[model samples]
Target: MSAELRLASGGAPAPETVHPLSVRGLTVAYGDAPAVFSVDADFPAGTMTAIVGPNGAGKSSFLKGALGVVKPLSGEVRAFGGPLSRARRRIAYVPQRASVDWEFPARAIDVAAMGLYARLGPFRLAGRGDLDIARAALSRVGMERLAERQIGELSGGQQQRVFIARALAQGADLYLLDEPFAGVDAATEKALVEVLKGLAAEGRMVVCVHHDLSTLQAYFDRVLMINLRKIAEGTVAETATPENLRLTYGGAAQAA
Candidate 1:
């Protein structure tokens, strides 16, 4: 996609390449309390980024606000240089697993195929071709063999993989995941990391709200540290500094 245009200092029309995801002066609140403060940042394609902060730091809220899942009190967000509504097809969001109702009766393939619902529109039903696409997605996450199994019947790791497969089926250019590795097994974590890294390698944008600071270096090339407000953002080595962590995590940084 082409980037949005901006006027230069001389008022001349200058071409400016917009990042895959960009947010400016964003703030989200619940009632009178603000979860995320005015934040500004840009996420480019072909990179995996980790959004990290302490508990109650609004990492998830930041994402929700940016994606329009939760209305923000203030600010703007752009996906591929346009409003999110215009870039919906290019974006895929996998919400926090805990927020999902796993008890709902649905087969693994059924769940994966739901990703195609956007493409199918409200009037059409998923056909055999759609199921084939979903199956291919499950295979990418190494869960093709269990395609017919009930989603609730799978282990925590397997369940996570299924959702990821669902996201993959979207064929989105930018992916937003909320704590994908939170409660998965070591093997699952490794597998998830590999799958995500592969997406970035394929020139897709991958952003996740991650809690495990130890794996930051291994899993992401960039980091956006926030605590209701953005503390710092840059290459992991530059933004995940001791001082920045101290600012973002306070005493918790010492404990971690």
Candidate 2:
């Protein structure tokens, strides 16, 4: 587990190059009990990876730790081969839709504009240029038409898209999303998948906490299979096998 596995379909990526995200001996806990065990993993640049696991499997906790929002009991997280603090500006995180209170009195465009605040810092407010960028990001996610609508009025998928637009407005080099496809329809999933692929094509790293196993190969370049700890990590072709899926999902995977 010391050496990171190469996920290239052609072959392993060049060893001389550095990974965009590196986790070492990471352990995250919500109390005395550890939710995420020591997970050492690396994500290379320019790839879309899915972090798939069952419910309550600590997938979201891993994301929170990686984003520095959840404090780790032990270990370290590095981005762009350096400390996360140095790379904070280059990272964007999209939280799960269920965690947000849609009735919080905000327009769709207003939610998206929050992304630009990274550049503005805590004390500053978004101005016209920021609003323009926010609208552009909303347009990218196909949510521009609903910019004036309240977030509470949008559909589940539309709300998800608005959150993504918010992340898009950040203009970060790496993106992490949690359960983005949870309640979305087929059309929304397709659109979101294409947008994620486009991000990778632009040499940005995209990691998602996904639940779907069937579409793993079709949508992502790499897949990280976990069950409270790292079980498998590599190209979808390699790590998404039935045996590994079984190990990650146990009897549930078999039942499915």
* TM-score against truth, every candidate: 0.94, 0.91
lDDT of 2 by residue, 56-150 (tens): 78899988987889998888898887899998878988888999999999999999999988789999888899999999999999988999999
> Tens digits of per-residue lDDT for model 1 on 1-256?
2434556679877767789999999999999999999999899899999999998999999999999999999999999988889999889999988999999999999999989999999999899999999999999999999999999999989999999999999999999999999899999999999999999999999999999898899899999999999999999988898899999999587444
TM-score between candidate 1 and the true structure: 0.94
Off by over 4 Å in 2: 1-16, 254-256
The C-alpha lDDT values of all candidates are: 0.94, 0.89
Error of 2 at 254 (Å): 5.0
Q: Which stretches of model 1 miss by more than 4 angstroms?
A: 1-14, 254-256
